[model samples]
Every structure is written in C-alpha cells, then in structure tokens.
Target: MAVALSTLVEEANRYLNCAAISDYCPNGLQVEGRPQVLRIVSGVTASQALLDAAVEVNADLILVHHGYFWKGEDPCITGMKQRRLKTLLKHDISLLAYHLPLDLHPDVGNNVQLAKQLDITVEGPLDPSNAKVVGLVGSLAEPVTARDFSRRVQEALGREPLLIEGSAMIRRVGWCTGGGQGYIDQAVLAGVDLYLSGEASEQTFHSARENDISFIAAGHHATERFGVQALGDYLARRFALEHLFIDCPNPI
Candidate 1:
C-alpha cells in the first residue's frame, strides 16, 4: 500500500505536533521526493551509510531524528552536505526528520522509550519550569547500587556507558538522551539519585561529584535509536507502508 508523500508528511507533522515545538532544524519534510510513499527507512541520523542502505532497499522515504539545515550550519550545500542531499535527490527518496519533536513526544519520545528500555517508571519532567528540558525523572522498581544501574544501562544500550558513581544507591533517577548531559544540574535539582544522558561534558563530572549524584554517559547514537524506530513503526502501522529500521552504528 502507498500513501501520498504529502499525506504522509502532513499526518506525521500533525501526529508529532511539530508546529508546537521549536527545533534547530525543520521538523517535517526536509527533502522532497516521489509523490507516493510505500517503504520507509528510519534511523537516528541521516548519514551517508544510512542513505546508501535506504537506496539499496529502494525505500521511498527516509525518516530520521537528525536532519540537515541546522540553525548555524553553512547555508551553502557543499562537501558532505552536498553528497547527502545528492543521495536523496538522485534516488528520489523523500527525507523526513524530527529533532526536538521526537525527543519530546510523549508516546514515542526518546526519553519515555529509554525509560521503558531501562525499566524505569516515569514520574514527571526533570525540570517542570523548562519545557525544553525533555529529560525525565523516574524510578526503578527498587533501589540498586550505582554500579548495578550502570550495568543495566550497558546491557540495554549494548554499549558500556561512562559511570560516575555516587555515594548512594540509585532509586529516583533522571535521564535525557542525545547530548543531554548538560541537564545534570536540573536532574540534581529534582533530587534524583542518578542521572543519565548521551554525552558527558567536562563539567558533568564536577556536577555529579559535588552534588553526589550518579552519572552515566551512554553513547548518543545508542541512546537515541529507539524513538525513530518507534515512530517508523507507528507510521508504518498507520499507513500500511513497509518500514525498516537501519542502524548505521556510531561509537559516539
């Protein structure tokens, strides 16, 4: 079954409530392709490898959490940018990307999905005052040692995360995926025993140590893999389109 490209994009935008969320890049259709869509390939990023894989599969559309044309990016399409755009244009495959929308989405959001993967029962937003803080505060079924929690994270993400052990066991936890380590302070303010994010900054260690909060920096790619897959499955089920999740793994 095939849905029109416009219909698919419209439904996706509406479902994700893209207009309500402010993002670094455009949320809906980034690259225009064929009028009708049948197969969709979803991934964390629209890297050259993913594009090539999608083309090999004859995907009609490529869906991603990271897309082109960022706020401060060079407007001129050259070098890597040129090649990426060329792939989409050459194969006539539409590119659809959602950044903050995917992270903030309540049902298919990365934060919520990560919680499910880690068996954390979500409580509330990490920072209630800041809507942009897509990280969440949650709790495990029972308290576990910081080391044990880190082991669980590694097991779930298939990557050993950087662990900054705290003085206490982990119970109330907070997390945000994909470069959200900066939210550690907010997580601390929420009084979580531990906080997890994609990439850890230099200051993250200081914050974790000083505040006595456990910190884990899981790979950004590994942490963000779930949202796009969930969104793709949703669209596929909603529109009866064939969907494939292509993981072009990245160490970072």
Candidate 2:
C-alpha cells in the first residue's frame, strides 16, 4: 500500500523528535520524489552505491542516516554530488535523512540499539550534561577479559574489530557508533573499562592504552546499519507499507 510522503515525514519528525536535536543537515525530506511511497529502502548512508541499489529495488523513497547539504560542505554540486543528485532526480526517488536525531533516540537510537545487541545493561549517557547524548555507558552481563569482549563485538557485528588492550578485565562498557572513537576519553572519565566506536583514530589507540580503557573499532557502516533499518521496519509495520533495507557495505 502507498502512503503519502508527507505522512511518512511527519511520523519521522515525531518519532525522532528532530526539532529538539540540532543537526548538520536537514533532518527530514532532503529530496522530494513521488507523492506516495509504495516501497522504501533504508541504508546507513545515501551514497551513490546505496542510491543505485535503491533504483534496482524500484524504491519510491530512500531513508538514510546521512544525507546531503551538510555544514561546511561545498555549496555547489559538482562531480560526485552532482551525479548522486542527478540519479535521485532522474529516478524520481525521494530521500529522507536523519543524523543526530537518529543517534540520540532513547529506544531506537544507534547507541541504545548497539547496547541491546551487545547485551550491555544500560546505565545512562556517557555525558549526562549534554542534552542530546549520542553515546552511552553501560555494564556488561558478566565481566570478561579485553580479548573476550572484542570477540563478542566481532561475532555480534559480523566483523573483526580492531582492539586496543587496556586492562585484564572489562565489566563496564561505553559506546557511540559510527566514527565516535573520539569519545573514548569521555568514556574513560565515565569509568567504563571498554570503549566501543565505529572508527578509530591514531589518537584513539594512544588514549585507550594510556587511560587503561579497552577500545574496539567496529566498522562505521556496521555499527550504524541498525538505526535506519529499525526506523524503516517501524514505519513499515505502522503504515503497512513495503520496506527493504539495502546494504551497501563499507569496510570503514
């Protein structure tokens, strides 16, 4: 069944509370295509590959975590941006994107979703003072060695995580998925023995080793795939529309 494009956007805004969270890019309806959406495709990023997959699936709307028109980006569309925009325009497929809003949602947010998958008991935000905390600190079900913890992350996400040894035991863990390795320091201050993020920086390894906190660099695309998929599944069940998740895997 086809649902009005406006209705989908409205629900997304309400569900994500997009207005409350400040984002680099617009949170809803980045591109307009069809009046009604019969089939929707969701992905981690709205890259050329994901868009091409959406076209292959004959998607009317593409839901994503990352969208175009970010702050500090080139104002004019040139080579890559031009190609992506042209494909969406030529194919008449809508694009719906949510950035921080998707990451900060309590129930379906990336942080919470990852904690659930990793079997960590939620404690609270890594930084409580920050109104919109995108990262969370929690305790594992049982205390495990740093090696054991890394193995769990590898198994759960279906990817080998780059591990940095911190301590012998890891009971408490903090995480912010998708290029959030920068938050390892904050997670350290929060007293978590382990810090998990999608990407790792040179400084990240040093910080983890020096601060006595275990670090896990789980792929950015892998850590972030859940939120968009969860949102798509939710919208699908709520409105009785067809929803498909197109995985355009990225090692980074």
Candidate 3:
C-alpha cells in the first residue's frame, strides 16, 4: 500500500502536534513530488549530500529536520539552493521537514529522547509558557556525580561530552539537543542542578561558572539523531513502508 503525500503530512502533523504554532518554514511538504510514497528516507538535514543519497535509493519522499525555504534565507533560487530543489523536482521526490516541531514533540522529540537515553524521568518542559521550548527538565533515577553523569552521556551518544561541573551532584538535570545553550538560563531558573545541551558557546561557560550550574555539551548531531530515527521507525511501522534513517556524522 502506498501513502499519499498529503496523508503523510497530516499524519506527521498530528503525530508531532505542532500544527498550532508559527514556524520559520512550512512544516510539511515544503517541496511536493510524487503523490504516492512507498520508500521514505530520513535524515537530520536536507543537505545536497542527503538529497543525493535519497536519489540513489530512489526514495519516494525525503523527511528531514532541516528543510529548505527557511525564514531569513535568500528567497531567490540561485546557487546551492537551486541545485537542491532542481534535484528533488527532477526526481519527483517529495520533501518533508519538521524543525521545532520535531524538537518539542513529547515522545519522539530530541530533548525527550535524549532524556530517555540518559535515564532522566522527564518532569516537564523547561519553559512551560513557550510552546517552542526545546529544553526539558527531569530527575535522574539515582543521583550520580557530575563526572559520572557526563561519562554516561558520552557513552550513550558515542561522543565525549564537554563537562563544566559545579559544586553539586546531579539529581535534577535539564537538556536540549542541538545548539540549545541559550536555554541555560531557563534551566537555572527551573532550579536544575545540571544543564546539558548539544553545543557550547563562549557565554555558556560564563553562565555555568557564574550561576553555579553544571553544564555538559554533547555533540549536536549525536544528540539529535535519536528523535528522528525514532520517528522514522514509528512511521515505518505505522504505514508499513520501507523507511531507513541515513546518518551523516557531524563533529560539532
């Protein structure tokens, strides 16, 4: 059985429950191709490399975290953007992207998935008021030393986490995957002992030191890979389609 593009879009929107919010790009079907989809390819970013891989696999649809037509991007189709769209259009391969929706989804969201991997029982969103809050807060099953927790994250994600330990052990932890250092303040205000994110900025170091909150920066790509993979597996099972998640490693 083949699924229509519109059907897939509707299913994904409902699954993520991010239809109510305003986002930088169109949430579903940014570039339409075939009406019926059988084979679906999932990736973190809809880069040229990923598109090429999709083409090689004769993918009917490409689902990704970062899609084209983002706000503040050059509206004109010129260089790389034009080439990417041209390939999709030429091959009649549909493009679907999630972005913030994928991050905020409770079950398969990046933050929630990371928490689950680290054995953190999620309490709630780091900022309950913001619908787009990508960070999450939770308690560890048992309190462990900051160093031990950091090592656990490293082992789980297959990358050495950058740790900035404070004076306290970590029982309560807050986390957001993929360049979410901006949420450190929210984590601090939420009274979390440790804050974990994918990337670390210069200001983040200062924030951790001054605020007395432990901080860990796991790899951005490493942390985010889980949610999309989980989502792909769910879709594959639900639709009975051939879905494969192609991972392109990123060190940042």
Candidate 4:
C-alpha cells in the first residue's frame, strides 16, 4: 500500500527516461517530502490550487507534468513561487515533475495519448530530421473536413479550439500537446493536411494558409491532461499505491 519516496522517484525517472531528455525544468523530484508515500496526487501543473487540492486529500506526493524551477526563471523564491513552495514544505509532500520526458515517452507521452484520444493512428515523428521535436505525425482512418476535425478536437478536449480553416480535408495530421505551434512548419514539412497544437502563435495562421494546411489551437491545459493521468495510473498499478488526478483547469 505504501512505497518509499526515493523508490517511487527512481522508478518514475527510469520509466519516463527522464535523464535522456533535456528539458526547461528538472525532470523528477523537484521537492523532497516524507520518506514513505501512500497516496499520490497528479495534475497538469503544480499550481497553488492543485497543491491545495493535494493537501486537502492528504496526499503524500504530488506528481505533475509542469513543476517549479524552470530554466531562466528568477532564482529568488518570492511571491507566488514562495507561496507554492511554502505549501509543499508545510505539508511535506514530495513534488515529482516531468516536462519534455512526459511529452516524448512512447506509451504515455502527451502526443501519443492525444492521438489515441482523437482516434489518430500515429505514423512517426513530426520531423524525421529532428529528434528534439516532441510532436508526432498521424492519420485519421478517413479524410474529414477541417471543421469536422475541429469539432472532434472540441469534443475530446472539452474546449472550443481556435481554428484556422484551410480548404483541405484532414487525413494526415500532425500534433504536439503544449505550446507547440512553433512546430507547425515541421508538421507542414511532414506533409500533414492538418496540424494541431495547444497554443497558436501569430505566424501560425499564415503558415497554415500559405501551406494549405488546416490548423487548430486547442487550449494548452486541455491538450496536456492525458499524459499525467496515464503516468499516474501507471505508477499506481506498478507500485500498488492509491493515485488521484486533480484537474485545476486552465483556459489557456
């Protein structure tokens, strides 16, 4: 029913292959807590709301896709950062986070999970030349209009995504889960009829139009909800520990 905190962290790090991926933030165990863990709380981000929810549930550890101490963040812990850290330290709840690793993992990665959710059969990486790109190229069983695909995305993510509709039937598709509009060009190069990402930039629309590819910008939070839940369920089954996923929804 219980596992050591260190043991859990080690297995998670190994399972996600965290060390091999370079990320903006640390991959595992951002904060240390009690030696033994009985219950785990997982969320998309380690925001104060999620921490409060975790505390309310008396979780021994908090697992998330996004955690503190990112690259280029101010070293000083003040204000919001201070409050979040205080809550974790006050409750002695370990913080386990994985950024790129969770997105890149073959089974539980965000892109793969999203493909499963959208009924897209994954083909390969979005860019064959780039190993660092976390997106994937996939295909629907049949071609559908851009609007229909948009509806599918809205239905699955529970949010209306911004669509830059092109005059193309969506069949071969490409997607990345979080803030991956930057990879649209890569998706284009891969010859996808539609490309989906969590957030879209100003230039993304132009790329979709000029390249004759449909583009969808689903909310970053909505798109990334699957991976952490999958990872949490996996750890729960693997270690026989109770796991709960708390969704502190973010519109963006």
Cand. 2 Cα-lDDT:
0.90
TM-scores across all candidates?
0.99, 0.97, 0.95, 0.99
Please identify model 2 stretches exceeding 4 Å from their true place: none
> Across residues 1-252, which tens digit of lDDT does each residue of candidate 4 receive?
899999999999999998888888889999999999999999999999999999999999999999999889899989999999999999999999999999999999999999999999999999888899999999899899999999999999999999999887898999999999999999888889999999988899899999989999998999999999999999999999999999998999
Model 4, total clashes: 0
Instruction: Give the per-residue lDDT digits (tens) of candidate 3, residues 1-252.
Output: 888778888899889886775788888779999999899999988989899999999999998887888889889998999999999999999998888888888788888888889999999989988856778899988889999999999889898989999999899998889989999999999999999999999999999999999999997888888888888878878888899899877888
1 or 4, greater by lDDT: 1
Backbone clash tally (model 1): 0
| Model 3 spans with C-alpha error above 4 angstroms | none
Q: What is the number of backbone collisions in each predicted candidate, taken in the order shown? A: 0, 0, 0, 0
Ranking of predictions according to lDDT: 1, 4, 2, 3
- Positional deviation of 24 in candidate 2, in angstroms? 1.1
Deviation (Å) of 217 in candidate 1: 0.1
| RMSD of every prediction | 0.6, 1.0, 1.3, 0.7
lDDT of 1: 0.95
